[model samples]
Target: MKTIQRIKNVILLLAIITLTISCNSDDNGGTIIDPEPTTISKYVVGFQAFPVGQASPAEYILDLPSLESLTTGEISVEGQGIPLRGWRFFHSAGNTVFTAGYSDDDKCIAYQLDENGALTEKANFAFQSTLDNYAALDDDTLLAVELTYGGLSDKRFHFINAKTGLLEKIVEHPIDIDMGSGTVEDPGSIPWVTGMILRDNKLFVSYHKWLADGSYITPDVDRAYVAIFQYPEMELEKIIEDDRTSPIGVNGHSTGIEKTENGDIYSFSTSALSAGFTAASKPSGILRINNGATEFDTNYFFNVEEATNGGKLFWMDYVGNGKAIARIIVDDNIGAWGVFKEQGEFFKLVVIDLINKEIKDVSGIPIHANRYTSPMFVEDGKVYLSARTGPAIGNNGENADLGETHVYIVDTETATATKGAKVLGLALKGVFKISN
Candidate 1:
């Protein structure tokens, strides 16, 4: 009996030891699980603009929610009363948020975003312009445009200082091109209002050459160049032109430019040669201008017929680690998104690889085609494309909701777009930028 009792005690001790070891192993091993991913916030603003003779309206402000807590399928616009319009940021202000808009009458409104995401109205100066697009310089000044009725005569640009509310018209020539010098076949009109960016004290303004039909041709003209000016003095520095062609391999036109964090200007144009306007919906290509030499980077080129061209590259918002978030027209011939085939009817947001210069279709996001304006990055490593959310019209009589704009914050970091929110019509055009 004594021997048996001793044996039982030994067994019990062994069992307890084994159980303790197992518990310890399970606790330590289970706690070594992976951590959740992190992302950066993307700031965005709606380019809300209306045509002339139309009732002017105010743009809305929106706050994009994180991919983790997206329940309502949309982000919230924290500020309800703030209004904005055709505006651009100033890299000199450390990329501070500065914008200008038009109020009823001839006044141009200026605003700055405080650290708290609140817009402080800085200046309200009277501006007379039939067409205008404004770009902020540092935190003090902006450049915009003014044109006569029907935009047939002299169209001028104004340089307005945010501090003193002073407006100065800057037009070296009454018009961008010499109307009488050459027998211009098809003159594409400059966009209603043109914009300018100041870099190294040089202002680069995009010039639009109108076509003969009065309808502004897609951006892809070699004659189209970025006019460089000396700020404050507004002296002509140089007109930077690129090698571009027209839609259907016809006339050339170039439009949008984005300065990368790496100090390179990535210029994009609508091309006639690469993809005919009607087929690809418009001309498309991205030209890299560096060292005073402009070369069309094949990787960034969008050839509509080519499998990679997607459809046509419209706008490039920013350059990421190795790619860019842009709005590109994808052909419905491939049955993408079952979207409409009409030009501008079925636009899709795309993420283009800057290194390889290849574009990947990201049109799976649930939103209207060609609706997103500013595609920005968010804190969660997600791409946020602005969506038009409302029905057709805003009570304001302005072309209110283009397509029920909403925030499609996609996390391609995970190879998926996880966060999205749909706001009503007015909320679609709301102002949205990342905080925290």
Candidate 2:
């Protein structure tokens, strides 16, 4: 009796399989097969997994897909985590993404995206010490500025091979800014290197010398300064200055300036609430250099605050076709370490017309307190951004609850932003998209 029952159950299982296949076979005399995905796009975000607004365990990288079917996945370097904390800088070229630790580690890592959209460790480079400002020179090279605080002396720029993550060259530049000695009233000047541009076989590095005090004050508040160094030789050509704005770019981070489609360069200055950043010294705005010219366009000046009714320019990046997207601080009266400030509110996105010298506010971006945002990424003529509010959007938004971090997909033409994939991390260090 037991043998008969076992045989009967096996027969029933086979019959059910046969019936299911038959149902899928020729419904309405046509065959149905699932389609295959052709291309893959992703937003690679570095997750600083921590609480209390800072500090982290070993960091993780997540490759969140644009398509819904393929779930978001993490990129582990040989099954090991990448060591990143606080702010991170990234540069994307070819099918690879390059990352260097800022305000922290001395390591550089590259993740290569294959045809099937798998990010594997390509190389990991180490510096003699940690680096501050970062730039991508070309397909095979990356530039990192190792900065020291006081008066910008003995600063070094290391060029690394992107493929192998090895140091190829070094440019040692001594920045000469007259900063007072560290006393109660006069703290010396520190070279706050902001960003770099490579053109005409030379490197144009933008930075400002600021007081070493925690107030974040700029000592030389009269002119915008750019250090010109001949590439490969690393010889100082000349320091160019214009009495146009306070500083060429903001104090920290790298996206304060960029080259546009027409080979023209435009830079934005923060000129926020500080001793030298007052309106008499400089109002935050746009300044440009004509293509192949070393001097700032003397005839061109676009005062962003004057045009936008007192909105200070926080950051600007060239999106495509001579246009840029910027973040503005309207009425944020937070402190220097606003990263810990939870109640302050006022940050928005906008679009800038470089050719026409116009600034217009962008719509669809929510307002919340954001102490800082990372460098932006542009791919396929679209600007990918993280509306970085940390966790303050929760308490400040209409919902009045803790909020999560997300990236914004901006339509540059329309000046409207659409929400992208939800990022998993404390700080939205940056977003990069690798394409085939």
- Top-lDDT structure, candidate number: 2
Please give the TM-score that candidate 2 achieves against the real structure.
Answer: 0.77
lDDT per residue for candidate 2 within 326-427, as digits (tens), equals 877755354443323322345678888878777766776676443344567666656766654433334324332355545666778988877665544444
**Candidate 1 Cα RMSD after full superposition onto the native fold (Å):** 13.5
Give the residue spans of candidate 1 off by over 4 A: 1-58, 61-105, 112-120, 147-155, 162-175, 181-195, 211-224, 230-232, 247-255, 271-283, 291-309, 331-345, 370-381, 389-404, 412-415, 426-436
Candidate 1 Cα deviation (angstroms), residue 400: 11
Q: Evaluate all candidate structures by whole-model CA lDDT and list the values in order.
A: 0.46, 0.66
Each prediction's TM-score versus the true structure: 0.60, 0.77
lDDT of candidate model 1 versus the reference:
0.46
Summing lDDT over every window of 10 consecutive residues in candidate 1, give the lowest-scoring window.
Answer: 246-255
Per-residue CA lDDT of model 1 for 358-419, tens digit only, reads 76666456434433233243444566555443232433444443455455665544334533
